[model samples]
Target: MSPGYLPFKDALDLPAFFCENCGFWQRHFTRPDSCPLCIDSRHVMPQRGWHFHTVEEARDRYPCHWAEVEPGVWRFFNDPIDGIGSSGYLIQTAAGNLAFEGCGVYSEDALALIATLGGVQVLAASHPHSYGAIWQLQDRFDPELALHPGDLSWSGALCVSWPFDDVLEPLPGLSLHLTAGHFDGHTVLYDRGRHILFCGDCLKFELDPADARRATTISAHKAFVRGIPLTPAELRRYRDVFAALDFTQTWTPFEQAANSGRREALTLIDTMMATRPHAYPVPLETL
Candidate 1:
């Protein structure tokens, strides 16, 4: 089935409403609108839940792990399952800091690392599936939550409160582009200074070094998987979107050897897009 398209740019003019029950936010279109969380009967909704957490709680819950990607750019991984490392990033931008792809489960150690780096000023995700602990990060840092307009509908009630956008210049050295591959709203972060890309699930891992350029079968990382219903044609469109991006390095949220291997990572993604079994076949005209 074809996925629904959200007019995210249009929703920007709408007013923000919050739900007392679930602490989620939504757009107030009418005098008596229902709360997205509890669907409250009243029209007036609260706004406290958008980022519900004290500074201390946020610091204690979310821990950060750092990796020197190049020079000034660093990638922070949020270890979700304790031992199994998942993907998350902390880029030191001229505009303070930016976090790409957050983990749902975090620890105090992670939070401390984030704090040491002067805290996160903007929280963004590659796609809906990667939005594991975005609400938590927003609450802790109170940064603008930048998301791809294509995936805005996935935000649901939370979309009402946070500021959404198609593209944003979070920092002078950083820019995020919408690259629909794994999900329609999937995005990739580009670091101009270091030429590094933080790609969540748009690309898969190539286990074999010799066959690194070939697409291989692998299970989707839970933090980067989405439930969006996609047709084969849509998948092809997504692949096209990602192929257009000019990137030097691609990083995942895990401790995979592929993260540091740029050429291998790009080759794996290229093979997957060109030869993978599609859920729906692309039209010859489009190809």
Candidate 2:
């Protein structure tokens, strides 16, 4: 008798690999030595050293799970800190399902759950850091991966089909806009109908997460983990883009899915502003 489950490599017949340090997936016939993104300023080398894994290893290592963020939005993630720790989201619409933030691990079980949700028609992410095994997701679902040209060099795998710039509306009521704070070509997705902003790594969520629902205690950074801060001008770009978006709640990879505070998020750039020439943006003094 044959086994019920298909092997990882056999099931998803795609030439893709992932970095154990960052969890960003790339396509290659055979595993290449040294990941470029890991050595970049933003990611840097992990203290444990370079750890690479095949798609099969990723599957065996982590157990994938998901939860409903809203009626049409769902969060798919892998528990336990395997890599940088990221979650992918699925926004179901009549136009088609959009997989926001590529999920890291791919399994038969993961596919089954997605099938029940109308299947994915697109895969997109704000920046490289939040991108999991996107190449795998694209191969499995046969959806166009919406990526910006600014960060194309960071892609370990060449799976991008829909290269958009500035702004794009791939699906009905869903718009992708450039934020470009944490990483160039960093984009945020706005669900016009749902009024939620999927603001990837552009904003860092504080550890405590007191309210979880409100977008307080969040900070913008050039590199949050490395203490790198974005310049005042960069923050200005953030302000301009976010102010134009008509979102009530914000979703970030640094934090779990929640209905974030509207006013709190909209005014985040304002609150982070202060006297210039400081190491980081200082809160303004109330005179």
TM-score of each: 0.57, 0.86
Clashes of 2: 1
Across residues 1-287, which tens digit of lDDT does each residue of candidate 2 receive? 11123344343454667788888776666786767778888776877776777878788887788888689888888875466778888999998999988667857788788988878888889888878866666666778778898888876464567888799999989999998877888999989988888988766554335665543355567886677877888888888888887776678875653544345554556655764312243221221
Model 1 lDDT, residue 117, Cα: 79
lDDT of 2: 0.73
Clashes of each: 10, 1
Error of 2 at 68 (Å): 1.2
Q: What is the lDDT of residue 139 in candidate 2?
A: 62
lDDT of 1 by residue, 187-252 (tens): 777776776667666544444446442223322221222223334454455445445555555565
Model 1 residue runs over 4 Å out of place are 1-85, 156-166, 207-244, 255-287
* Lowest-sum lDDT 10-residue window in model 1: 278-287
| Among all candidates shown, the one with the greatest TM-score | 2
